[model samples]
Target chain A: MPKHILRLIILFVIVIGLFLVARQFLIPESFGEYGHYRANSIEENANHDIKYVDRAECAECHDDIAALKQGGPHKNINCQTCHGPGNLHIEDPTPENIVKETEREFCGRCHNKNAARAKLIKQIDINEHNIESKCIECHNPHEPWN
Target chain B: MELNKKNKKTRRDFLKLSSAIAGSVAFYSMFKPIESVANRKTDVTEREHWYGFGFDIEKCIGCGLCAKACKIENDVPREPFFFRTWVEQYTIKNGHIIKDENVIVESPNGGIDGFTQSVPDKEIFKSFFVPKTCNHCYKAPCVQVCPVGATFETPDGVVLVDDSYCVGCGYCIQACPYGARYLHPEKKTADKCTFCYHRLKKGLAPACVDVCPTGARMYGDLDDKEGPLVQFIKNHTCRVLKPHLNTKPKLFYNALNEEVR
Candidate 1:
């Protein structure tokens, strides 16, 4: 072989060897264990804390309220939907940890007159319907119709 | 002269043989059955879990509780533009034929606050709410476009992004046909719904499904033949968003109108 060609071949081999060595250090240990991603990432993502408690957990303690809600249109709504996340409250069992929204705007979120809202959902113009009073006073949140 | 000629002939033959051998080796390597690193590691037939999601458009009440619950559960950005999930209100104007111009779609605050009807009742012919989220496609464009291999699909068929590995080049965000991925403002990485994989791992429903005021949203294992998701699909003519895109979206919608995108 020509002297120049031999030198070129030697340089190419060294460059390729350096690249392979650098790749070993740069690439994650679990990079190819699963698909193209790092396998440990799956476990890291699954380790997130559970923030929202199931409704069945609430019903265990508040069966009376659950029974009241079951007989009404709100039966399908989860207790935590309006009350907010109850994971902490479930552990501590404190009334202050959970919300009890009684404001008209809170109820109006779903019920207030909106053209886009489903017709099946009974909507009212908040300003026109029983002005200057909370919705819970006239309409029970657990059983609004009754 | 004869000896010199014979030596030249031998040299030419050696060159030809060497060239032929090198060419064959290159051709063989090109067609070799090398294992694809991108393909799922698990055997599809033996997969213990393959999750799917479905929703009934008729059952959705436009209350936006599901949208609210998703934000609170997932810690998605409070900004209107950065949502892991959202609700869009579609209104078809009265006396107007269904067309791109006639249909009005709006999602204010990603419907975290309930929607207010923009189109007057007299002018509106029909309206419905469509809750949107990551479709978790079987052939995900986001996963395919992630140059760093940061985004991938799990064995259970949920697409997720590894924030640590992401360079945040925004290729995956742009590649998504469903407009599902968003760049996280704080993390500066591509973020989207994981199908609530963390919650799913703990044997719980996704936050949106958990808080739906009407039984509009549902989640179940596609592997389970008797699962509610399978039964619902069998019973109803469920449609996926942008079926022609060939994304193979796991999110199914029942009573999906022709007007919805």
Candidate 2:
């Protein structure tokens, strides 16, 4: 190929490549809206594995509290994130997953991260907060905004 | 028989022509977009899905019912910064800024009762409410400027964001001249009032439609003859928010007592 022709071909390819790479920066993720509002991927639990019921599932008995949670922000998040999942608790809503102290541990799992780069946040002194405070103190696990 | 010199062209001639083309290209790149924006017009020109809402400035009592209900339905954050929808209360006296109805804040519920006391100095003081929400412009600037198609007008004409798709870069947020869109804090996605599309799918009205204490906020198809908007337009000499821009916002404000001149 001629020298000028070869150089022209290389320049065209470079410009087109630039457009392609810049495109990724232009588009945002598609799965952000109504994210956890839909459903979570669940795996089967062994019979011995204990679980706590979803807030909505538990509403069959605790209607008042569940009703209040409906208006709160964290309404879509699974109960397991706070109380733990209820795959094994189909028969019983109460278990170690439903413990009163689980709130501190669950939030601590993320907030207690050593790095400041954490996007999600829940700040409570596990020792001090757990002694008296809990996750519900600032946020309702069932409803983050509430 | 005249021997013609080879056809001659000077370098200056070529340079001037090239410079003119380059200058035109440079100038065109800057102001051409304005013309393109003009010719592009808005999707509302088709009179299709521009969801124009009207708030009677006089009828609005400043009650924040719309905001509160929207927050619950869409889970909008109530913190100091982000706002999907808002209201601007204006009280104009002879086109003068009277009553300082400027809330300049994003509140779902403007906290006004939509009723004002009888002002004795009616000329000096008259109060009115104007609730602002996503205009759902036919040519949605948010959608156009969105680096991602995260914000788009649905086929039905209501503008919506596929939160699942939004990257929360806030390009749409900044592009909106009307400042309707915002990035959610936790979900980290762009969000705005959807006109409660989830309800519309069920053949029910939007949450704001259901909760507005007064019929201040109204929604209807601008194209349908049987739609209230058609009749509303026929009866009322209404004004659209910033119609000069020709965004063709579906949201129309009825009896907009005072719009920026």
Q: Give the top-scoring candidate (DockQ).
A: 1
Compose the digit string of candidate 2's lDDT tens values, residues B1-261: 133344455798899999999999999899977866565424445434544565554444454456545665566777744555555444344344543453122232343222222222334333444677788888878878766456666545677776665678888888776778777888888877777766555444565655443456677776677778777767777777787777888776666764432
Candidate 1 residue spans exceeding 4 A from truth: A1-13, A114-116, B1-31, B37-40
Using lDDT as the measure, the top candidate is 1
Candidate 1 lDDT tens digits, A22-135: 999999989978778998898989989888987799989999999999899988888888898898899999889998989987888788887666578888988789988999
Residue-wise C-alpha lDDT for candidate 1, range B204-240, written one tens digit per residue: 9999999887788999988888999999998999999
Per-model TM values vs. the true structure? 0.90, 0.50
- Could you report the Cα RMSD, in angstroms, for every candidate shown? 3.0, 15.4
Q: Pick by TM-score: which candidate is best?
A: 1
Residue B131 lDDT, candidate 1, scale 0-100: 86
Model 2 bad stretches (over 4 Å): A1-146, B1-51, B92-124, B259-261
Q: Report the CA-based lDDT of candidate 1 relative to the real structure.
A: 0.87
